[model samples]
Target: MKYISGIIAILLLSVFAACEDETKTCDSTLLSDLGMNFKKDTLQGFLVKDTIWPKVTLYAIGNDSVLINRQPRSSAFMPLDPLHDTCRFYLQLDSIAIPDTLTFRYKRVPSFVSPGCGFATFFSLDTVITTYNTIDSIHINNREVNSSNDTHISLYFIY
Candidate 1:
């Protein structure tokens, strides 16, 4: 009888241990919270502001869909000094898939321009729509142009 009782106690302890191990609390702030329903994969987007001088707007699109509406964001803009000729912007994404085509639209705000340029140019621009698959990375650059200097918008994505 003693031996039987000991075995029963051991079995009960083992059952309790197993139950404790099986209980797990799910994290509420997971990728699912972001609306990404992939069971075995995750998608994320990040924006990298390279500079704060010029102060332009940045937008992002994925699979020809506006992931980030053309919202204005600070961009690298400096006084039209002889030294500065080009403007740079950056955005980052991880574990994302690019659709067949993506479109980027940007408008530069003239308010950020210095007195060097006679009149601000708001050059509405769009990229040569192209498709992307398994895009591991991406970057966008708006070269110097003499056009309307309104808040500029651009699109970049990765898969």
Candidate 2:
């Protein structure tokens, strides 16, 4: 009976150790999503840095899943594909009939974290392509995107 209790205690300790290790891995490695800030621009070069959209819908090209669905927001975060060097998105603002397309080109740097933890992806912004249907211009704030959720790009809408 003592031997059985000892074995059970060892198994419980092993389980607790595994849970602690998983927690550490999760804390270290996180999904790095690209952050975007919105702004309003006038023809006279007046810039409103923190412009809020009444409603915004966002999704990726070639994917039916919508990332954001008609939400009022001034900033958003979009995930980039670690397997691909480029990602394309379609965004509709304030019930606009025509949606603007944003293409992001980046260099993906994958870091092998551990055997149990797969990898963490970091991105360096290369270029951004946008359809000017509703968007006026784009500004790259930070070229590097990683675990920190900082604004990497800013979108300027013509007022």
Candidate 3:
């Protein structure tokens, strides 16, 4: 009976130890992501904002995974390289034969949120360079990108 009681106590202690909370997870929403919005110039002397791309494919230059596949998209959220000072992306529109290259120059600022949330990299856009193909020009809507639902870059399509 003494041995059985000792075994039961050990099992209970093991169970309690396993139940301790030591899991730390970083929130996905806190990632440093850049938002891009698309717009087109209307012949009616006004810019039509949030213009959708009927067939668009976008991906980072070095990355194999595609961010925006061949689908209709009006906006896109892409993560910047935390270790690099610049990031490049390939944007291909359906109507355009040559894909446009977008290069973004930025400064990565590492910010500490909390103990559980380690660190987040924020970006300050210095400048943007793009090859004119389907895109006529680019505008920096917001210079600061801090994982918000705000448009950081506005891409104007050639009308």
True-structure lDDT of candidate 1:
0.32
Q: How much is 31 displaced in model 3, in angstroms?
A: 1.9
Query: Cα lDDT of all candidates, in order?
Result: 0.32, 0.85, 0.83
For model 1, the stretches where C-alpha displacement exceeds 4 angstroms are 1-114, 126-128, 136-159
Span of ten consecutive residues with least summed lDDT in model 2: 21-30
Q: What is the TM-score of each candidate against the true structure?
A: 0.19, 0.76, 0.76
Better of 2 and 3 by lDDT: 2
> How many clashing pairs per prediction, in order?
27, 0, 0
The sequence of per-residue lDDT tens digits that candidate 3 reaches over residues 83-159 is 89999999987745478999999999998755567678999999899999778878898989886668998888766
Which pairs clash in the backbone of model 3?
Answer: none
Candidate number of the best lDDT: 2
Q: Which 10-residue span in candidate 1 carries the lowest summed lDDT? A: 31-40
lDDT over C-alpha atoms for residue 49 of model 1: 27
* Candidate 2: regions farther than 4 A off: 1-25, 112-118
- Candidates sorted on lDDT, descending: 2, 3, 1
Residue 149 Cα positional deviation in candidate 1, in Å, after optimal superposition: 10
Clash count in backbone of candidate 3 = 0
